[model samples]
Target: MKWKTASTLALLSAVSLIGSACSGGSGSGSGDSEEVKDASAKESKDPVELVFYSMSRDSEASFNERYGDAIRKKFPNYTIKYIQRAQGSDLPDLINAGTRIDIHWDSIGSFPSSNMVYELSYDMSDLIKKHKVDLSRFEPSLIDAMKQLGNGAIYGLPVYNERMALFYNKDLFDKLNVPYPQDGMTWTELDELAKKLNVEKDGVLYTGFSPSVNHLFLTNQYSLPLLDKSAMRPTITNEKWKQVLELQLLQPTQNPVYQKAMQANKGKILDLNQFAKDQSLAMFISSPLMPLVMKEELSKFNWDLVSEPTMPDAPGVGPQSYPGYFAITKMAKDKDAAMEVIKYLTSDEYQMECAKKGIMTSLKSEEIQKALGQESAFKGKNFGAFFYNKFPAIADKTVEESQVPILATYTKNLNKLSAGEMDINTMMRTADEEASKLLDGLKKK
Candidate 1:
């Protein structure tokens, strides 16, 4: 399970919320069962009922159907069962029982890890050494991040590794006679592109959210060099952070990207998918799961994802991590079997299938070639560049770091206040003030 969590359920809820915007970071899973099995299990035995736990119902169901058909029919000795939930389900009580709970998939740095899980369940060094698994298969940064977290030990396997990219609709691009984004566009370049595409004449708006200041992911990446949290102080006065805030206040005359207020502060009802459905906006910064989200909202609009603009002088490799992984509890009865389940889900073969379906995976899935094989909305661009491994784990020690509070509780409520129902300066001040108090309270505890 991930070490950071606002709630046990936040990770689950995040999956659906960003299901289209963030790549899958949580590991896949099914249930809690009795660890004990019949002693003579190896011989002419009944299929092993493997219980799994997970938050993704659709992806897990698909994996079980495809993988189970191939393996189970051939071996006829394994059966898989899954237990799915929305984010925030309290699962410790179930695991505290003697139930096997074969495996659980969750976000790495985002899911709650305190009471539910930790870094100790996995013995990665042994498994890699014994299995002869090639660490070379993964990029160096990912391996380095793991080592940093586990005191230089491989703690767990990643299932849904992800980062943000600019996904723009091609229909609008053609209509506006604008060029698509190339690699390494600076904030200035993004502004020009948006200006070229801003085609709002008869109430129809065509603009770029490409480098929108309001987007936290884009702003964060742009400021990574100055805001490493490792060496820098958490000062709001930092110019880079102020630029992030400026992104939210779109100056249409300068940048042409359409601005849709899918209020994170007001607890606004419109989801990302809903905003796309309205078709008033053009580009959106989202995850690989964009296709899944588009299944409902996209129509007549051809869209593709591009690597997010990197910091001018920052050293991150590429593709920012969104944080998710799975683990077994020290309290489990069938710890061995539970661990086996984790191994299977994180296996490259399973991850490959997920990537082909455009389901974002954390493991370095081979299926990515399948996505890259065809002509795309990106026109032979290296989409994989957005996912390059990291240089170091994020070291933010802010209030959001201590606890993964409900993003909407604070962000949403503030949006309502900004719509002239309240005041912007007052709203921001209140948030900083309230958030500070909350952080101090958590520290005391």
Candidate 2:
């Protein structure tokens, strides 16, 4: 999940209910996206081109195959060039090239701290209204979600926000002799299963658990704020923060992946796929997108998804990074044209179309629900947590403001602790202290 797609990996898979939950099942989706644009749009005399940039993440090909050529077919007046940013700094370089870079991807969270972007992005409220776009068609929770981003402007919007749910390998569950759990499984139960499944082998140990933890969601699970609004500094030493760290510490012996390998073998990177691919690991706590990774890597192994265990057998409000909307760029030379693109993309027709691609659609329209509800493989399971979920997730306002470096440093140490280099208490204290210092530094700057 880029910034929006980004956090689904962090909170949902690892914890119970950290993102917005969208319920889907009944709706109409347009099978064909033939442009229903005005005759004026079709009869335009001159050809206009829109140069756009995409993060071009792994899922791009599927999106392009469905969305790209069809969009061109619908809007023939505009020639669209997509620059895939496969590596670093292509955005600024491209903008410098005067490519008319009309549309670009901006993770609002990354925009503020970068300084290079504020001057470039367009304010889209007017464009949104002028196009008679139906902002109400989206999930209502997202309105405030935008407020948490760069200066509270709708600089960029996501087609759909991402929410995470736990993804467990059913084959691993069978191998470990553990049973799948229901949505409200207690942490104690999850840990008990982890204890049984985790095996220590030649210098390494791998098991069914790990937190793709980040401060915004993980810390917040215990009700900790990234910074105290009044104090404006890292306040992880508080009760909420303590609880957050304690949850991760509870499973001292488990690693997210590599159940068959041990620390003596020195596996530094214990990722979600370990359980999915390595088979050494039995379960992965991650976002819905984990399936995409699993589908590609562990084709032979049968797998399933489960939701994160709720705290004390109660549903927890979490999972960060719900996908957002697609807004018109202020820098857009043709605001009307850009809004049309966004309108169409966010419309019921387009979103429902996107649903068939295995990527969940955030549209509140009937079509989106029907598509998702019908996706049996991606939906809930018997005795397993709901695989694809929508929950109230924390948006990364901190990261968007360049405060992510603060959390990044903290998470790195947290990972180290999971690897058994340090005790949880020591890691927590150290991270809390250092994060506070970083926050202070940011304020001074």
Instruction: Judging by TM-score against the true structure, name the best candidate.
Output: 2
Q: Rate the local accuracy (lDDT) of all candidates.
A: 0.45, 0.51
lDDT of 2 by residue, 277-352 (tens): 5666665565444454334554667666555665552355544444534444445677666655556556566665
Q: In the order shown, what is each candidate's alpha-carbon RMSD?
A: 7.9, 6.3
**Index of the highest-lDDT prediction:** 2
Model 1 residue 305 CA deviation in Å: 2.7
Model 1 stretches with alpha carbons more than 4 Å out? 1-49, 55-63, 66-76, 86-89, 96-98, 113-124, 147-153, 210-219, 222-239, 247-275, 315-319, 332-341, 361-431
Q: Model 1: per-residue lDDT, tens digit, 1-445?
A: 3213222223222443333221112222211122221221232154456665654443554445534343343335656665554344335445444445555555544433432333225545764443334566554445655555555666555655555666667767777777887656654456667667656656555545533222342225532321233432223334554454444232222322233333321333222442355554456556554444344455445766566654444544343465456555444445444444444455455555455555455555345534531232233534564554232343332223326342322343333442335544554455445555555565578
RMSD of 2: 6.3
lDDT of 1: 0.45
